[model samples]
Target: MITLNSISKYYETEAGVVSALVNINLSIGESEFISIMGQSGSGKSTLMNIIGCVDRPSKGQYLIDNIDVGTLSDSNRSRLRGKLFGFVFQSYNLLPRLSAIEQVELPLLYQQIDNRKERAIQALISMGLSDRIHHTPNQLSGGEQQRVAIARSLVVNPKIILADEPTGALDTKTGLEVMRIFNELVQKQGISVIIITHESNIAEQTNRIIRISDGKIIEDTDKIVKVKA
Candidate 1:
């Protein structure tokens, strides 16, 4: 459902042009659970940002469902982004004052969708947070807070979820629980989930693992190897 062709991203730093990603060619199919693993400053997050439409590539093409993303107008890009992707982060980026329900409802506010409260409630309930819907970020545990973030993402019914270091702040058990939730999203909901993480154990749980180093894809587990004479 998504394709990246020789995508490269560069930054104009005070020193000079710095390349964050170099010729990143990838294809992500619908409902695929994939993990991009790399060390710090290895361009994994940069790749995710480009894929999610939060940033533009300095060169090359990104297409979603045969739509060229680089050719879209800014407003059109925003519309496509909201329609196609939901995002989750390591830090639960919830407003301190907003309750779980309120946090989940924020996304619908932009779309002007009807029955916002009901939809938000259902999303929270699906995340096993029916009772905690009234609680704020501070009132929820780390896992609960992350679930709230996930619920907020799902409220949009996005086709793809781009999660950046989603389990970084949680304990081992909680991290595993979060991964289970992601797996369910893929298996049951048919959502394409692309997660960026440094942990091998976490990446192993996904169907495909892609390793990036110094702005290049060094290994892709899904690629078939050819035996040579």
Candidate 2:
């Protein structure tokens, strides 16, 4: 339910203008899982930022569920982002002092939501962290902490999740478990998940893969061409 049409993002540098993304076009569908893969400086993160509404494209059109992002004001952009997108990062960006439940509740709390604790607990439970709700970041394993990050993202009940190298810090087994949770979020919760990763195995698990190079999408493949319903 998101489309990027003829988009370009550039930054002015002392050396000159540096283009981060160029002539990009993409449509992310509802209930679909897509992976954005590329080596460093390949524009994957730029694309993610644009999609996440954390930053606007330097040029080109972005429509999220048919709303033109280019036309939104700064306040509107942040508001729309909260309404539409949830974000998870590789760093497990949890507040050091907030318990897992508290971390999860933060999103809803910022939104001034009611009964947020109950919703936060349920979200953590969905991420398999019900037993660790009261634990702080220092108390959880890397994977558990990442799950807490995902729980926080889910607390707001956004339509999409943008995860960047979600498993980078975890051991293989734990990474797989984290990936499984992401897959479950897709299959069960029906969230549109867009993950940016360099790992091939992780990328393969997604429904579709979009590969980028030199600031442009070089490959977009639907695994199995189609999955049997």
Candidate 3:
């Protein structure tokens, strides 16, 4: 339910203007699991930030369900972002002092949602962290901590999840487990999950793969081409 049209993001550094994303055109539909694969400086994360409304493109249009994002005021944009998107990162981004349940509750707390505790607990339990709800980040394993992060993202009931290297910190087995959870979200919850990853194996888990290089999309596995015999 998202569309990007000729999107380009640039930064004015001392060296001159550097483009993080160039001519990005993409459309993501409902309940789709997709992966954007790229190397360092490939603009995958920039694309993610733009898609999640954390940043706006320097040029081009971004529309969500036919609403032009550029036309919105800051407050309205923030509201739309909260309503439509949840984010996960490789760092886990958990507070050192907050328990798992508390971490999951933070988003709902920001939104002033009712019954925050019950919702947070259910989110964590859905991520298979029922027994570790009281543990802090330092007390949990890497996979458990990541699951907590995922649970935090879920409490918002977002239509889309933008995960930037979500499995980067975990072991291979744990990474696969995390991927399985994402797949389930698409199959069962009908959430659109867009993950930015460098690993081909991880991208392979998704239904479609978009490969980017030097800030431009080079390959999109979802695109259909018909060749005449």
Candidate 4:
């Protein structure tokens, strides 16, 4: 459902031009769970951003579900992102003032969808956040806050979910719980979930793992791994 051909991302650093992604070629299928693993300077985040439509590629073609993202207009790109991609972050980017329900509903505000509140409430409940519906970000625990972020992303019913270091901030136990949600989203909801992580243990659960180094894709293969949870 996603394709990238010789993709490269670059930035002008103080020292010189730095390449984030270097001539990368990748294809990810629908309903698949994949992990992008690399060290700090690797292009995992840059790759995810390009795939998620949060950022554009500096060169090469990016075809998301056969739709060439580079050719899309801003509104079309925004619509494509809303329709095809959900996003989770290292930090749960929830609004400090908005409750879980409101935060989830914020996306729909632009779509002119009816019954916004009820739909938002239902989405939160589906993510197992019903009991914490009225709580703001600070009122919830780390796991709960991340779950709220998950709910917000899923509420849009996007075809794919791109997560960047989703378990970075949480403890091991909490990180596993978050990954369990990702597993559920792929196995049950049939959403393609790609996460950028640095842990082999974490990448083991995914159907495939792609490793990047110094802006180039060094490994893209299916790995055999057990899922204890």
TM-scores, each model vs. reference: 0.96, 0.95, 0.96, 0.94
Name the better of 1 and 2 by TM-score: 1
Ranking by lDDT: 1, 3, 2, 4
What TM-score quantifies how close candidate 4 is to the native fold? Answer: 0.94
- Stretch of 10 with least lDDT, candidate 2: 220-229
- Residues 1-229 of candidate 4 have per-residue lDDT tens digits of 7889999999988999999989998887778999999999888888888898889999999997688999999898988888788888899988899988899898878666788898889888887888999999999998898888888888878888888888988999999998999999899989999999999999998889999999998877753233422
After superposition, which runs of candidate 2 have C-alpha atoms over 4 Å from their true positions?
A: 222-229
Clashing residue pairs for model 1:
none
> By TM-score, is 2 or 4 better?
2
Candidate 4's clash total is 0
Q: Record all residue pairs in model 4 with backbone atoms less than 3 Å apart, i.e. clashing.
A: none
Off by over 4 Å in 3: 225-229
Sorting all predicted structures by TM-score, with the top scorer first, yields 1, 3, 2, 4
Worst 10 residues of 3 by lDDT: 220-229
Please identify which of the two predictions, 2 or 3, would achieve the higher TM-score against the true structure: 3
lDDT of 1 by residue, 159-197 (tens): 999999999999999999999999999999999999999
Candidate 1 is scored at a TM of 0.96
Q: Scored by CA lDDT, what does every candidate get?
A: 0.93, 0.90, 0.93, 0.87
Query: Candidate 4 — worst ten consecutive residues by lDDT sum?
Result: 220-229
